[model samples]
Target: MATYDPFRDLDRLASSFLDTRRGPRRMPMDLYRDGDHYVLTADLPGIDPGSVDIDVDGQLLTIRAERTLSAGDGVKWITREREAASFLRQLNLGQGIDTERISASYDNGVLSVTIPVSEKAKPRKIAVSTASDSQVVQAHESGADEPQPIEQ
Candidate 1:
C-alpha cells in the first residue's frame, strides 16, 4: 500500500510552479586553447541541427538554438517536465583572434567553434648581433648603438 504524503505533494507543486522554463536559457560550454587556435564546445541536446545558429559580429560571438517538444492534437500530458525552450550564449573575442577564419560545426548534440590566432600574435625569435666586444662595452657605457672613436 502506498502512503499519501502531503509534504511531498506540496513540494512537487512548488517545484512545478518555480521550475517552469520561460524565455531563453543558458547552455553549458567549455573553451580552451589548442595550439594556435581556440576550441569552444557547447552541449545542446534534443536540438535540431538546422535550428542551431551561430554568428560573429565584430568581436562578439553569439550562439542560439531552439528545442521543441512534439504534442499531437489528441495527446494529453500526464506529467510534463520538459517544455520547449530557446538557448542563447555570447562571448567577447579579444584581439589577436582571427575572426575571419573562425569555423564551427555541430555533431552529436555538441557545437564546436574554432578560432584561429592571427599571425601577428604568434611568438617569434629575434636575432641579436654585436660589432665587437670593445664596441659592445663602449656602446653600453655611452648608452648608444655605436660608440664613435675619438678624433686625433
Candidate 2:
C-alpha cells in the first residue's frame, strides 16, 4: 500500500497557479513628483504604440491597450494567443491641480505622463526687513540749565 502526502501536492499546485498568473496581464508602473509636475511611467513591451489610449475623467486616470498576436501566411503558430489589456488608476487631484496643462509621451516601451501643478500650489518667495523707522522727540523745561552739547 502507498501513503499519500497532502503537503507535497498542495505546494506543487500553488506554484503552478502563480506561474500562469504572471505576464503582460499584470503590468507594473511607477508614479513620482518632479518639481512642478507629476510623472507617471509604466512598462509595456511588445505592444503597438498606436493601440494605447490614455484618459483622465474628473480625478481618475485610465490606461488601456490591445494587441493581436498572429503568424505569417506560410507559417502557423502551434499556440496562438491574443492579448487585450486595460489599467485603471485613480488619482485624487485635491484642490491644487492644473488638469488642463497635462501632457504625455511614450518611448522605448515606456509610457510617461506629466501633470502640471496649479499656480497656487507652487512655492513663493517672500522678503523680510530688519530695520525700524519710528521717530522719538523729548522736550526740556524753559528754566532748565543751558544744555551742554554732548561730544560725539
Candidate 3:
C-alpha cells in the first residue's frame, strides 16, 4: 500500500501551474574548466537532436531544445506527466573565452559544449636564464656601468 502525501501532491500541482505560466522552462546545466578549455553539460533527455539549437552572440550563449509527445490513433491517455514542452538556457561567457572556436556535441540526451581559452589568456611559464645572462641583461639595460668610489 502506498502512503498518501497531500503536501507533495499539492507542491507538484503548484509547480506545474507555475511552469505553464512561465512558458519554456530552463534546463539544468553544469559548467567547469578543464585544462585549457571549459566544458558545459546540459540535460536534455527526450529532446530530438535536430530540434536543438545553440547560438553565441557577443559573449552570450543560448541553448534551446524542444520535446514532443505523440499519441497513436485510438489511444486514450490516462496519466500524462510528461507533456510537450521546450527548454532554454543562456549563459554570459566573460573575456578570455575563445568564442569563435566554441564547439558543441550531443550524445545520449546530454549536450556538451567545449569553450577553449584564448591563447593570450592561457598560462605560460617564462624561461629562467643563468646568472651570466642576467648580468649581461643588466649591463645592457644600464648602457654603461659607472666606476664606484674607492673607500679609504
Q: What is the C-alpha lDDT of each candidate?
A: 0.88, 0.70, 0.87
Instruction: Report model 1's TM-score to 2 decimal places.
Output: 0.75
Task: Predict model 3's lDDT versus the native.
Answer: 0.87
**Number of the top candidate by TM-score?**
3
Q: Mind giving the per-residue lDDT tens digits that candidate 1 earns over 1-152? A: 99988899899889888986687999999999999999999999989989999999999999999999899999877998776889999999988999999999999889999999999998889978655533422224456776755422
Candidate 3 lDDT for residue 137? 22
Regions more than 4 Å wrong, model 2? 1-26, 78-84, 126-152
Query: TM-score of each candidate?
Result: 0.75, 0.59, 0.76
Q: lDDT tens digits, residues 7-32, model 3?
A: 99899988877765447888889999
Residue 147 in model 3: shift from native, Å? 20
Question: What does the lDDT come to for candidate 1?
Answer: 0.88
lDDT for residue 82 in candidate 3, whole number 0-100: 86
* Angstrom error at residue 144, model 1: 34
For candidate 1, the 10 contiguous residues with the lowest summed lDDT are 132-141
Model 2 TM-score is: 0.59
